[model samples]
Target: MVFTAKEFLQLRETLQIAVVKCSERCLYQSTKWAAELLNSLPPLSVADIASSQNTPGTYVHPAFAPNNDPIEAALEAKELGQYLLAKSFFDCKEFDRCAAVFLPESLLAGLLAPPNDASSPVPGDKGKATASSSSHEVTLPVLSQKSLFLALYAKVISGEKRKDEESEMIMGPQDLGTITNKQLLVVSRFLKRWFDERGSGAGESSASQGFLEYLYGMVLAKEKNDEEALSYLKESVQLFPWNWGAWLEMTNLISRVEQLNIVTPKLPQNIMSFIFHAHTAVNLYQQGQDLAMSINDLISVFPTSSFILTCKALLNYHSKDLMAAEQDFSNILALHPHRLDALDHYSNILYVLNLRPKLAFLAHLCSSIDKFRPESCVVIGNYYSLLSSHEKAVQYFRRALTLDRSCLSAWTLMGHEYVELKNTHAAIESYRRAVDVNRRDYRAWYGLGQTYEVLEMHAYALWYYKKAAGLRPWDGKMWQAVGSCLQKMGRDRDGIKALKRALLADSYYDTSASSFGSTGPVDRMTQMDPEVLLQIASMYDRLEEEDEAKAYMELCVAQEDGGAANAEAGVGGGGGTILGDSVAIHADSPGAGSDGEAGEGAERAVGNEGTGVTVATSKARMWLAKYSMRMEDYETATRLATELCQDGVEVEEAKALIREARSRMEPVNMMES
Candidate 1:
């Protein structure tokens, strides 16, 4: 093997070409041959153009240069060679023999290596360690190859491999890639495991601490092999008490499976994971999806858990698997009836779906929670209301209000009870108290308005009604109230517009069976005024003159008193017989008949609600005659003129009455007939 420099150059060229081809098939494998060929080049330094031609996902092709431009990389290569040679023949310093030409340890490690055989020393081997001790007999300066391999392997096994080699190899610092924390951890751990496992000492392999297995589990989890991942994680935790990552990743993995509806048998080793699965199932059910599978999963995984059983019951309720949901709810109640969330949710479902009697069942539950959780009282109170059990509803609502004075809903519900019991004044007071607590409480405002309307306090009703409408514009019933109250108050245009909006917004009858509907109940409001007049007059006429007092004044008065004179005068003159009955019958009487209109032109003596324009005009004439006799005093004229003003007739006459009445204290003046 006496090779000339030209011969060395030719051999290196041939090896580099072979290495470039071999890199395609194997990276380290090709690098092994390339290093040997570069070793043959035998120069002070060669251009070790270690470029990697990478094509997208393919491996990088190797090139090299030991030139000055890459002196640092070249030095790292040299350091790597020196380290390897020292390991193989440490005491003899055999790597110095090859110092004129060599590669760094890391670069050489990255260099493709030939396949291991019986001849190549194992990457981590006890067999090569003593080769260093044997080399101590050799002389210094020129080193042997065997010495180099021994020293390098010692550095590798000890984790004392110089990091500066990697630093030096990167040029311009821009291409300096860092070993990420995770990667460094892997390398350090891998080396430690290898050295410890392969130590010459026989008992070194036995130990309880085993991070490697946990790392392997992480590998399985990353690969998404759930069963294998769980297996490795279990083994890791069993072998090592402090491998927190393994336990955490396993719990997280199990939790996620439970999320995807994948059921599993409970893991006896992991109580937290078992409970987490049940919780996950419950959450999914609440999201509007069918959670029957989740319930079944919980049942299978945690058959005896109270939390699991409780959730199953709720799922059953939603599925109308009523028996199951009820069973679950009952089980929960039996164990812990004071669970506010469970009790409230169960009661609400019952209330919304119109399940009444169950409220009493809830009432039983309420007593249990009331001592510890007073909010449950409200839940129980609602149960009583659901049954139209107004007395009990009132009882519970008042109890809840006592516990939570700021409970606007409790106050509102109490008011509703009053309304059901026909205690309008009491209802109004409760609603007003509720509104005082929450001025924005739309329900309270609405309830107050309804109570006032029933009590015939139109002005008060209108104010509360508008507040309710403003708070909840989407509540068509509120808008409908606005329309209805406005109509009654003679604000016709605004009322009609509000009513139309109510109709449009409340178009869907299924949701709100209110003022707007697809059915014939639509005409109810149009008939209100007539219906009211009829009922009122009937009650009044029953007592004759007393009927007027009952309806209009609510009490009898002396004739000299303000109300008594007006009642006796029969504003619609039937000789002091105001008919005190229906408006229709008043017209049939002399109020607007031929005799009433023509005879003495006395139709002017009709009541405020009597008949036609003809009757009204005739009454005005009589009033005119009275005006003349009274010497400019004109109560009769004013009354008749007011009627004429309302009918859109003789606008001038109506205006004159108002002006003349303002000018003189006596009633509106008439011409001296």
Candidate 2:
């Protein structure tokens, strides 16, 4: 086995190649061969190997270099063996083993390797690590810069793995928190050292530098230093414009920062096209452009991107294209079953579609993977609530609150569950917590109002309803609640104003039948709508203007008849009145007939409800009878009261009025005699 120096170098290079190309099992099998190959090699420095002169039929061994430490050769062999083993483990996803074997060896190799004089200053602050020239030089039997980075990466991943495993353990919260904190601290120190490693020096490409920055950004993100993390991640993309990994990292950081209303870093013009296209499409959707078109254009460029497809599907769901959105989401799930975004989005779609079985499956699957994610917990809670399992729903909702107390929707939903369970006090507390979490949450404010209204706290209910109205002025139901609360509080003028606003916002707005249990028999089921009209009429009547009251009563009659007609015809007017138009009927004036529309309009105003006109006649006749009696017009009063008795409403009152009018008429007749 006598060999030239070049032959020895070639043999070592061949063994290094074998180590890289073999699998873990193959490497183990070849371990003895590698050891023998290394042991048979002469103690020759690279310079000695290069300087050796070729001699015919003989090996050339040059003079030893001064810096050639014999121990360095052994250390190199040990470092190479460890690096290969760790790499194999890493490739197999055995992070713990990789970290255990590689990190120490990589560190020791750097310390033992002689520093290079030709290398530049280490990057970042002064006193950061500097790499020797041989650090990343991928020669035989030496740890390269790639190996060092991998070792650090494995260590960080191992820490994360421990944290994840411990989180799933049934340990005390305090103990789990302590252990997780220590693991994070260990990872943070390693990341700092990885960043400080000057050995992965200027010779590395800008893309590699970007990778380092990305890793540092990830550490900063874990520490909740989002601003610095964003800065480093942005720097990474700027340094390596071609790296998709960097782009994905930037997208994740931007999404999180934007959720907190934090300003994102400005992207450079040289940004990657796929990210730019996707970002632009989403931005256009936010700006109220045609979301479908934007998403279509994005998909045209990136047809296979699940992220883009998911975005398009979400946009479709929002736009009410449920079937199309469902199909797209299904496609994404089929392609990537574990995609969190797709799972989250499709869960909502399933809920909306009332596909309860699928929703349950999605909730269970998502919870299995993301047990502590508040949104996933909330989804599970909603599934239980749908099943009328308020008790189970509360458990999941409470778990969501524990995970993130600031999840306002969870609090609001918990309030809904409490309300369903008739736990008014708990409901109130949950709503209050929700509002405290986000003052702009009108749902919480409305919930509080509803709860107070139910509790007969009119003043408190009014205050909360007003707050809700201010937050969501266009919500006609809130305005209606405000009106009802005001009316309960005897604020007639304000009540009328709120009621009118409610009508203007939503003409069909009606108070819930269940809300007025204690106050009045009037509710949506029992024509609560007509009650609103009557309330306005009474407010005017209280001002001693009987004519206006009579007019409103007529309008109420017209609305009732229209609703009946719609129902009989099987035409859904959705509880809206089909009064031809807003025709002002003045007090003390006979109702005139409007002719030739879809139906006859008040054809014979005095008593014909069948034509949508006579519905008002019964109330009108009653009011006219009262007015005539008050004016001493006895005959008119008697006749009108008699007609009122024929109608089904106010029969006993009409009979009494008739008796009184006739008795008074007898006196008048005697006077005439």
Candidate 3:
């Protein structure tokens, strides 16, 4: 298994403290633990070993016995001598020759009496059997039993070229007596110097000192009889508070204590502590460098937190591990199957993961919950919409509105679906409902307007478009819709007005410059506005008043480019060109129009009530008079232009238009004669 590194380090630290403590506590109880801790290392003695080599309270140097091995008492007597030798060698001090003369006696027996002499070759009476020994007659040097034993062991293992004990280097010292104050001071001096001068790792050792001591109480060091193997660590930390390496050791030790304090306990305490731990874990998890451990522990401890699961799932999702994130979300579902937030989030996850099958699954789930929660119906509707199932999408949308009349999004989408299905009337109704549900919804109003425009109901379409525009006046499309509907109703002037508004709101868009609506296949309609202008031009053209038709068509042409071009002469500098151009109008001709196409609107165009007559309308009246001339009605043509010259009336082009009108009237009536 791939281990999370941070978690592994934490586990290792905790394990070290635990195993160390176990070794310490079981040292004297189980031989295995003790052997593991001590490794059969020796101890130092405060007094001498004796003639009863291995016997207690007997003073005999172990090496000074009459034979190779000695009685128990002799071994105990020499214990302090072995320790002193070890201390002197490790301390780099000279050995005492007087102590060496007794041979194994001083080496083995320093308790009852001091060695007679050092390096004297003799078999002395001290080797004689002495049955009684007095405690008061003995004095031993002071040494830390810990350091003394270690120093002796160091010599034993040093592989030095020693002549007498070459083959006996593996022997272990048996009865190292109590530690002396001087030896302890020597060990302490070494420890203090190492810690004080070492790198900042000392602080960690200090922090962990108490904890280490606690564990040491149970098991000695792996090297010797003492519990701790690391002597310099605690001293270092004590000497340096900022020693992080040592501090880390301490933290590890503390963590192990904490972990073991409860981990192996019965369920009741563990569970209670777990609950409390989980409370703090979440915050710490995000605090940097603490995530993996936090996650592992929390999930193991408090596996039921839906909120945590969700947050974790989101983290995974954002991390680009969809499979893992999906698993978390699924687990969350198991715990909170009816979670609305989960449903929404899960659907989105599916969308991103491109899990088509799961999309359907989410759609079904949302659909099933439609009755219980109206909002879910909207989700189902959108899902179907995404699937391109407009019919079903619309069905669910309507169903959602049925469940809750205030379902604004459902109403809005239902309208859109209807539009997709080409049911403009139904679409308009749905859009209207959406707007009613939320009057602030400009989109629904816009939809309603566009649908009406599609249905060819320009006036009603214009009404809705205007309302939507009012809501979001800055919206380019809304303004575009208004202009389109107005233009469709044959009000190009108003269309231009609305389209300009669109451009002003959003200068970067093309909505304003683009045409308002379809004008069929008529080239004339491209430029024609002031609908009366087109009507008059057509009337004159059909009456064979070509010159008048030509002049009026030019004005219509100018108006088509921009309705602003066709304004009255003094009205805001709008000077419409007077000359008309020949237009290829594919729509109905004059006769077709004289029927219902030209109704009240046409009559209003030619009526004599207004002074500023449209160019096309004015031409239409004069053309009617000219047409009468073909039937020999000169009097009627004359009455049409009573202020013009009386002469030949030709019908050709621009000049012909003026020529004809002059012939149809008396010159003297021109200026109100």
Candidate 4:
């Protein structure tokens, strides 16, 4: 295929679009084709095209002219061609071929040579040339530095693949851990030599040094030397802020908000830094106006970027705004259907919403695209989980972990499935592994609490629940778990405190979407979980706070009634609650009430058994009747007991309460007579 200059420009624009959209497959195919095209072009044509394009960091020698010097033009063409080919190979996962293109034979030989051999040639000297007529030495092209970084990265990845192969042969398929220093020693030594030579006033530019720094930091990070890796990554970002790769490396090293706050001021205040902050904040689940502002700013700068949209979707997911997250991810997939990143999250949203058809379709689509991907496996697992196929879900989740041991969602979801299957021990192990991979994962900690609670270990459950609550202070579920554990441990006052926090958290989350300008069809009032109120009321009753307990029980009944009325009036549908309005709660469903609301506390019962909201409400009425009798309000007590009997909930208890109330009323009547 032949391309005019205009066509070449169009191709470059296409590549840029692919990159901004985060379409790796598109970028890979384009680069591969472009490399082949450049290789077929004549030396002069290649030189003319390369010089004409405004590629950043591309250096053209002042003394060289394509029209005047055929030799110089050929050398430039060869350099550019090699770099393009290596990048294509890297994108295609042909890491060995990619590295071999940029790394000289001597360096490749030294990779296998003894570590003590000081006779190995430095990597930076590969493309250096001495001009025959001039005293000035020609430095390697700026692309050479990028080529070197790519070569080192390729080698590291190749080594990992070799390790995986060896591990499979030795121990069968299992979780492959982090890359060791021994495996990365070759690349580490090469980068050290490059930096040493550059530090000694070698002709390498700051940009070249930054690339080398990023490579070294990446190697160190893989080798689990995070402290040293962080320093190199920070320097790499400072030296070359345009290298988004380095910014990503820096983001990976800082997991905590405290660490991020300390590092933010030190980074260059540029577009890349803003992006880094936003990305890291999302991963850390640090929600605030600043994260929102950063995402909006990035959207303005890259309006067509699916990557930015994905980030926004992630923020919504972390904030528990399932409706907004669903919309954002839907928009992203509409624009770039081939995107595989975050599909696991999208599937999760569908599962929570009970959009079974959509979740199933997504799983089928992802499977068709690439079934081996961890994300795809997670999606499939969610699909099976939604169908109540716990074993099938576990199988797929295991496959996902086998593909990538650090897959946070895989571990967490597998734990959930194990819990569903009553395999509490397996669930604990999965959750533990998830926390080991990423301590910031509240879901894993929450799962651990649930598992311990199942085993009736209130002390251990409280500890794990507190850890989860600390990570997600605004998550009502975590706070509720903590409160439940405390109450079980006979700590009534502390349980009350935790339950109050849970109520506050729930209120904040229920209204959070409106604050974020979400015009989704959610009715914030109807989104309130009646179970939280019930739990608080029950706790107060246990504490002997008659007035407080009665007030809370009345509040729970009122809210449940209001929610039911709203549902009947069609005031909300497909919005507000995490389950959305579309999913009807069937009476036979283990955890749902007659009013179509799942009782959150009841749903947490062991063996998938649940006490419906109707039953809970009746119990509240029964207690209220008893309270009225004790307070000498016989008429009120009799009325409440009769209502409970009519409702047919707690019939035996209601009837007994009625007889007691009537007997007490007879004594009061006789006294009045």
Candidate 5:
């Protein structure tokens, strides 16, 4: 059936509205309707319209021959019809659909189609005007910029190579060489011309501008010109700050430069402000601020956001509020069970809470969902490690490595397993591989240091420990190791300084509250080897810092709990351990061993007359007796002195202290009190 000019005009408008819905079924119906309309319309030329005018063809129709522009009309109709039919099958979410319809080869071929009827211009060509026209005319608009952009986006989404498993490399620069060389060159030329024509308007184009920049940046980064690519990404974020894709691309670009220690241009102030606030709460939490309180305020502001709740849950986990963290994580799981990050962290909470069966089940579920994912394998491996199934843990870690050679956590955890089995050589190799894969990982550095310390290579251990401490200055454990290492090397003053820094860092990280809702004692020296505590005490003594010496010695005695040999021996059953990886070893010099022996002798008179005396308790009493004598509490000193004499250890020093205390002649009740 032939259509009147007005009918075709009305039909095209109706089809345009349908195409805007952008659904597969909607486009299919629109395409079918367009095809029927195209079939009914005559292929009218300017010559035919003009001839009709001369014939006074019953008042030449306005819609069919409005402009006497046959080429424009033909190109517009052709572009609309082709775009509708092709786009109907270009489902962005379906890889197969995109691959079949909008492949790079297919798209490039369409771009290279010969000039239609010689009246249409190629992509960049502004066709020459006729002899009757004064100005040059072009059909460049027939290139269908929107269709080209959508197809490019689809190709990028479909063809980009994601990592086999997550790693730092997942955020590393991509290799966008999926298309052939000829296709790449042609596509590059077309994009360059497209940019030149509309570049001025790009920044204001919002979503389109950001996406275009992201694509260009990806191409440049693939080719390894990071500086230029970074520039494009920076522009992308600046132009479209709300576009998550552009922001993620910018983050990847920044990570690429930062990993290489390459200097990047300063981001614009607006973008920096945007980025700063995103991470501010996390940084504050790491610095030991109350994240739950801060996050509660944020939750009030954005009550519906799962991300804020997730952050709060993670902060609670770090702060050791296990119950609160479990609840928050459970809430998120109920809402979004497929969130992998939440699942991984929630599984960790289960493990920490000693819900081993639940942890194993969750890990099994994660692996069943995607066994090839390195993270899933690593999670299962971690559960086995916690169970002391070193052999089983090693198998899973190896599996993770097979899936992703760049899995940094797997290498580090493998080292920890070797350490657990007391295989120093294998542990060292594993830790070295971990550091090789990721130089910035403090855990790997700490692992290497621990192995060296185990081998008694003090200098190597000191170097690696310092590296770990430098990477994570907030971690008191590394500083504690550094202090112990320096003391081993006979650098008493430096050791003292490092130990004090460790104490300060430990305090800074103590965010947990007591039952009374007050901050508890921040000193966490229980993790230190009792021998290290003794050495620190000795250092204070040599420095003539009596009060400091007494304080550290008291902590040492409390840690030892009357079992001096346990202090001398390496920590058994992982007493110094946190999270199964760390092994606590107190570095002891030959001189320190003799000092410990002397301390043991002084500890002989530990208990009351009827009570059994232990070496550590006697040492504590001896130190307390000396402290009392120094303070000139004669009565208490004389009592302690008599006890020491009866016990027959440190008798000479006790007698001397008693004599000195007695010379002060203090009242008995006042001195005792």
Candidate 6:
């Protein structure tokens, strides 16, 4: 088939789409096809077209008419062909070959030639670009901005790959961590030299400068020079807003919402800017209505985009709507089964829901598709974590980090696994690394708080918990941690205030009337967290605030009643028994009956497998008994204590309270007699 220039350009677009859809699968084949297509097209130069016009009976086609610059068309065709070939090599992981396609032979020869040698003039010298260097300049082909950027990027990747391979050969494929600055310095030096040669001449286009800036920014980012990287990336995006890679680099530099807000306005006002903002918002965990609006706008523009769908799924995930997030991810995968961007999050949902078989299937599928991918590793890690193989989970999480050092989920998940293994120090280190990568990740801050709390460092734990709470103000777990830490630090009033905030945050209360036309608000408060009420009541009791303590105790009792009613109505199962509760039991903790003290009665009660209602009722009665005794209401105290003894929870304490109440009542009875 004789392919015209326009036809070849169209084929290049098709191949690009195929590359993105299939990733590495078709890269080599596409590259070979592009090469063959390029070879089949007749080589036409300006000199040839000019010489053909002077030849006898030479026919010049209308496509190469005088109105059109045939040389420009020829150059365009050559640039596109080179770009397609280089991109294919890049996608196929032949970084050196990709770079060689763009780097001028003159520049490469100049680097190898001795500086003092008069044979090869320096490629970028301004004065040397006179008539004396015209021959060398003609030999160098003009490269497009994107082609140059890709070449530099390929060099960076090539350097990293070379270093990693060497390390792997020595260390036998263990986790080698992030690439060192020493390895990237080689690419950095070449980039600096290229820019120095280009200068601020009119010959350099704005697009060219933008690509160069983006490449330099990427190098600086990998070297951990955030300030410089941010400056370069910001400039690059402003100069060329369509480059998604530059926008992504900018996103990585922003670690906080404040920084994101500050940087957002500086971006160019265009569709890419909007997309960048939406992407950054998701990364920063800003799942507010504004983020939703931004996502909706992008979806309207690109309805079938898997990236937008992934963002939507992440928003739902952060909103605690696991089922909605799961469905969104499922839809995305159904449309684009080969996509590997957010499979880790889907695996997380499965792990939380305890869908062991499905998680296993996902892990196996991801491994089969590409085991080296970070998302696949994370999926496998979550599967191991679900199976209680925490050490294996950590190993895979570590491997994921090795693949992508800035993988936020791997660091945070590894910290969780470390915590499970009781490796507090290792967990702290992992959490700190995660925080260093992205301060907006509340999970890392929360993990840090939990680690410190386990170590009994209440002050440190409280600070970290507060940091997490500040980031995710609506997350009740963060507030609850803050409250617990404050209580441990003996700040009872502050602890109560924090606990109340947690209660408000956690409860999904419906103030509107029920569908059945109830006159009052429907008491549809899911996750009311009876433990928060108990904790607040205990604090109030310690403060000698009888009314407040009694109020919270009554609320706990009402909560249990509501739960029991739901169970009887078949709305949900009655909360599990104390022994079946997932929370660990401490002997000295309130409502935890001591086996040694209660003896055979506690054992029999535990064997009965009482519902959550029974546990809540027992706790409420125990507290009420103590409160009544404190108020000198001997009859009420005796009645409440007797009820606890019958329930068999805290049996020894209930019996002791009954004995004290009876002794006090006996004196009063003597007066009556």
Task: Highest TM-score: give the candidate number.
Answer: 4
Error of 4 at 299 (Å): 3.0
Best by lDDT: 4
Local error of candidate 6 at 601, Å?
Answer: 30
lDDT of each: 0.45, 0.56, 0.43, 0.67, 0.54, 0.66
Mind giving the per-residue lDDT tens digits that candidate 2 earns over 1-673? 1456677676455444434322222223234334333443456696865555455356523222221334434444557777778888887878767766745545544443445434565677354343444464433223433454555566667776666455632212342233442334555555554455544563332224354566677677767686888787777666544434445444544432234233333555531443444553342223124444555654554455666677777555433334456678778867666655445446545544556787788788778878788778877876776566888978887887766555766788778777778888888888887876556566678888888888999999999999877754544556777988988888888887786565444332122211211122222221213445556666667767776666555555545454343223211223333212121110000011111211121121112133332434566567667878888998988887886777666789899999999899898899999
Superposition error at 37 for model 5 (Å): 43
Candidate 6 ranges with C-alpha deviation above 4 Å? 1-92, 97-144, 166-179, 186-199, 202-209, 507-527, 562-611, 614-620, 662-673
Ranking the candidates on lDDT from highest down gives 4, 6, 2, 5, 1, 3
Error of 2 at 206 (Å): 9.1
TM-score of each candidate? 0.28, 0.44, 0.26, 0.74, 0.54, 0.70
What is the per-residue lDDT of model 1 for residues 1-673, given as tens digits with 9 covering 90 to 100?
2444555444455456446433321223334534443442434343332222224365432334332234334434556655544434433434323222333444333322222412544557766645533433322222222222223223332232233323322112332333222223333333343434445564422332334455546555544566866775666556533323454556545533343344334233343344444454443323223344544553553344444566666554432233334446666666654455456556544454344567566767567655434357667766665656677867776666655555665667678777878877667777776766556556678887888888888889889888876754544456667777876776655664565455333322212222111122321111011122222333334435433423322111111111233334332212221211111111011111112222222211122222223432333333342343355655555665665577576667676875675556433333332
Tens digits of per-residue lDDT for model 4, 1-673:
2456665554444434324322222223333323433332223456655765567376553223242334434444667778778778877889888878877546555444543343444455543222221222223323345456667777877887776554431112453343333448888867776666667887623434365787799898877799999998899878755455667777777767899999999988865577788888888876666677778766754555767788898887676666677889998888778768789989877776667788888999899999999999999988887778878888998888778777888888888887878888777888888887777787888888888988999899899999988888877677788988888888988887887777666555545544333554335444334566567778888898877788667655555444433233221112232211212111111112222233233222111122334655776777788888888898999899888888888888888988887887887789999
**Residue 419's C-alpha lDDT in candidate 6?**
83
lDDT of 6 by residue, 1-673 (tens): 1445555444434434333322222224333433332333345566644554556476654333331334434544668788789888988889888888877545656553334454444678667646444433322236555566677677777887876554432112453344354436656766666665667453533324366787789898888889988998898777655456677788888878889889888878765677788888887766555677778765654566777778888776665545556678888888778878779988876666456787898899899899999999999998887777888988899899778767888888888888888988778888887887777778888888888988999999999999988987756667778988999999999999888777555432122112112233433433245676678888888898888788667666555434332222221112321111112111111111112222222222112222245575579779888989989999999998887887789999999999999999998999999
User: Which 10-residue span in candidate 3 carries the lowest summed lDDT?
Assistant: 582-591
Error of 6 at 117 (Å): 19
The C-alpha stretches of model 4 lying farther than 4 A from their native spots are 1-144, 168-181, 193-197, 200-209, 288-290, 520-528, 563-613
Lowest summed lDDT over 10 consecutive residues: which window, candidate 4? 582-591
lDDT against true structure, model 3: 0.43
Question: Number of clashing residue pairs in every model?
Answer: 52, 6, 80, 0, 2, 0
User: Which segments of model 2 are wrong by more than 4 Å?
Assistant: 1-81, 87-97, 105-145, 161-180, 183-207, 239-249, 252-287, 290-292, 318-324, 330-341, 357-382, 393-673
* Cα RMSD for candidates in order: 32.9, 19.4, 35.9, 10.3, 17.1, 11.9
Q: Look at candidate 2 and tell me the lDDT of residue 298.
A: 47
- Select the stronger candidate by TM-score from 3 and 6: 6
Model 5 C-alpha lDDT per residue in residues 1-673, reported as the tens digit of each score: 2445655454444433333322322233324433433333345567655554646657744333332345434543656655564555464355325433433464555444444433543455444424213222222233333355555555444443232322333212442212322233444445555566565563322224344665577666555576887777667656534334444444444432233233223444442223323333342334244444555554553354466667777665544445566688778767656545546467555554555676787788777778777778777976886676888978887788767665777778778777878888877777787776566566778888888988999999999999888766755577888988888888889998777666555434432322112234422322333444566777778788887787666555454333333233333222331111012211111011112332232122121111133344456557767777778666777887777787677878888877877777756656888
